[model samples]
Target: MASNLTIGQRIAWYRRRRGLSQEVLAGLVGRTTDWLSKVENDRISLDRLSVIKSIANALDVSLGDLLAEPSLFEWSDDRGSHSIPALRAALTDYRQLSPMAVRIGQEEPPSSAGLASEIAEVWKAYQSSLYTKVVERLPVLLAEAHHAERFSHGDARHAALGVLGQVYHAAASILTKVGEADLAWIAAERGLAYAQESRSQVVTVSLLRSVTHALLANGRYDAAIQLTSDAAALLDDDLPKATPDLLSVYGTLFLAGSMAAARAEDRATTRAFLAEAQESATRLGTDANHAWTAFGPTNVAIHRVATAIELGDIQVAIDIGPKLDTSALPIERRVRHALAVAHALSLWNRTDEALATLLDAEKMAPEQVRYHYLGRQLVLSWIRRQKGKPSFQLTDLARRLRIV
Candidate 1:
């Protein structure tokens, strides 16, 4: 039942369910009844994300609901979705309460160093765009990190707590990617609690970034921007003695804020945030992935592209996005930048080039392209615009993404 409807049809369904008149819905989205009538009848296409987001907001539905994302999640090949339940269980596991509940194992928890190494492996998998692998690894890793935090002592206990915070950060990151922003928020809040308990400023700042991301994903743009700004301000006093990891996280915070500002259409604020990030990038002096941030000069540039796209500066996105050398970045960042470029190209009406860019990205990270909203939206838009049957390549990609 979910597979056959276009986005317009879905919108109509939701609008009817809410008992909204076309006049009321159109007014809510700042459009006329005639325009919305066309939209509901599939005579118009929602080519811009901002517009679609506005409609989704007006209809009181998530962007994913409008896009029919549940069907994609239910598809057999979406391995990331398959692990979400287990990961949720791990997050809620009662054994983390220690003496209050039955312990699951007799063996002592891994040492701080061992836990760090294991957590780093999960980050590595995530950076490589191996979402399924990361999701699969997180549940047990989460349980073990909790055990380590509970059993270890003194400095070892603090270190274990920091590792536990990082484990939750990873959980939040993966959940956000899979469109489970609410779950990501829960993971991030839990991580921040552990981070504060560990008394590590760096871990706290890093987890704040995760929290900011979750906020942005949930469309709390102003809250996300404020969080980034507040977090960035806290670090400024320590800037004189800041390490590379600290600088990386600091810069990435601004990068995230810049995105939030752009989404809010606050051009001046967006530019200001980008400049702040650029300063950090310049201080870092190279393309580095300190603290798994992938934050550096190159990443700064990538965010510029992303922000430009959000602000409807398609020319700016196309100008810098396609020309940048992101080879030094992680596969996840590289593929993400590629999708940004593809989005810009599609908006510029360079459909062939957009398809080529997406094809190239699919080769690099099939799961990333298939699961990413931009890629899926672009494919759907192109298919809808085709006067006749779409090319076999386009159809195949759509089928694989389960969005046809």
Candidate 2:
């Protein structure tokens, strides 16, 4: 019975199932009964992750149960139909359990240089928001990275391990983007393990950001914050001599921390994390994408807007979001920032502008606009609110996103 319902309906269903009235559930989540009634009636959209998570908690339900997100692969093009399954196979490959088996190198292991080149290509595709390309390439890359790590010797082996770590990091990132939170957690942990094995402090710390993201996806915001704080602290002693890449990684951790803190609704901690990230960005003094971190003043500014949106400061986000230029950032970052701006506009009841912003983002990264929860929820909310016939633009966007 719950399988064919919208999130709001499912919430109402679970509320009734738990023998709880609207008032009781509303009080549990710190919302007025009127607000809950709007939610249950689908008059209001639970678009914010933090708010949705709180409601899920109050209902004693998993976030996934509440959201019922479809697998990214299920709706992807034919070329990517098997990507998720292949990636799962690679991640859970039995050969990884037997170092002896993996070291045999059934095929010649890619050289450390070759692995690095391959990783760079995948990262470029990912940052460009070419998610389909990234998904298709990663399964093979994961298999080869493991082979390289197992087959090499000494320095080469360590380099291979670092490459392996990076491969896992990419897997984790894409998994999270696609709503495969559990798989993302596994990939991130595996990345950290390989990074530590290589004894690369910078890679290890950067991979912690991946783990933190995976944790955030699973609604473990406090854990994400603590992990980010500890990881950022580890970089302090080396700051003076740190390479740009290391500093990028360091600053990125704080940005991630800011996000986690914001999601947790800890305004003070969020501000502190943002301040630390800003300091690191100031020291760097320019926008850069070292270590694929994309950390710098502009990126920090983007996070500031994002965190404000998360903290329910729509006015603040609305004020700063539209004026900023994000051309220097990667397409992925640019599109995500656009989504945040659209969210702020939507919340402010500037529906036309929000719709325009989202359409512009779709032009740049249709895949992101399609798969991102914020974008999907925003469109859903707009469609739900339409009276009689919906606007052509809204209907077209909804069809493109396959959300209608």
Candidate 3:
């Protein structure tokens, strides 16, 4: 019976099976009965990682159990699909290789400048909604960058190592989206280690952002916020000398910290960090994709949509939805922003529009929009609400996502 329930309904079932009343379970998790009731009714989304973990612990279930669907592709009960395991193996194998193995002089080395161009191309591909391509290319890119770093010296070695860190950071992000939180953590840690080796604050911040995201995915909201906050504190004395890139990185951390706070239900902290980030965005004077983060005024607006939805401010999210321009963002950013709008539209009883918005996201990034757990969950909830037949669009999406 629990296996047939939505995540919210499953929570209620688990609480009842565990012989805990809503009030008792709420008290156990330090939440009010109203919050618990809303969650059980699916009136509010259980999006916060901390909130999900609390429910899991109080119900004595694992996170995987809480999120898993009978339709296997809808969610992973383990480390997701084979893609994640393969990605993990690649990272592990790369890390374990002997230094001598990477110094391959048998083939002509690509020019450092050309290798750098290829790295940019990879980032561009990722931003353009080529996640599968990015994942397919990463292992080789990482190996080549490692080999390049092993044979180079001075600025060449430094640049090569920086590229290595960037590739690892991208790997962490891709892994997280594919539902491999554990592997994503390792990728992020490795990226951070490589960043430290490069001794670049910009590189460090980029990797740190990925680490924070992986932490969020793992329900370590407090630690994620603390890590980003501590890093932000380190930049205080150097604030006057901060370049646009540094300021953008500072803004990126604040944005991430804001998300962590929102996940923890700390609205005050969320707003405070958002304000700080807005100041930095203002300094940049435009919505630039600094350090490939897309952190700027327009980017903040997209986050505002997400934050509003997370905080159950459906009206707020709806109000800000139309102001976003799909053109101002990369394809991935557009998908993210569109998903937030879809969430808002879904909650506002605009189910048709919500489904349309989701379809738009699918058109942009077919694979990502198809496999994401939240979108599938939301559609399933809607399907359950249908009096007779589900709409064809929703049905097709569910079929594609394997949630039927």
- Candidate that would win on TM-score: 2
Which of candidates 1 and 3 is the stronger one according to lDDT? 1
lDDT of 3 by residue, 284-321 (tens): 89888878878789888877778877777778889988
Better of 1 and 2 by lDDT: 2
Q: What are the lDDT figures for the candidates, one per model?
A: 0.85, 0.87, 0.78
Clashing pairs in 3: none
Worst 10 residues of 2 by lDDT: 68-77
Of candidate 1, the 10-residue stretch with the lowest lDDT total is 70-79
C-alpha RMSD (angstroms) for model 3: 4.4
| Candidate 3 positional error at 61, Å | 5.2
Better of 1 and 3 by TM-score: 1
Q: Can you tell me which runs of candidate 2 are displaced by over 4 Å? A: 1-6, 16-19, 74-80, 103-105
Tens-digit per-residue lDDT, 1-404, candidate 2: 42235678778988999999999999999999999999888888665678988998998877766765744554455674587878888889888757666443277888999989999999999999888788899999988888888779999999999999999999999988887888899999999999999988878987999999999888889999999878877777899888898888988998988898998999999999999889889999999999998889999999999999889888889889999999999999999999999989998889999999999999999988887767777887788887878899999998887776
- In Å, residue 41's CA in model 3 sits off its true spot by 7.7
- List the candidate numbers ranked by lDDT, top first: 2, 1, 3
* Cα lDDT for residue 310, candidate 1: 88
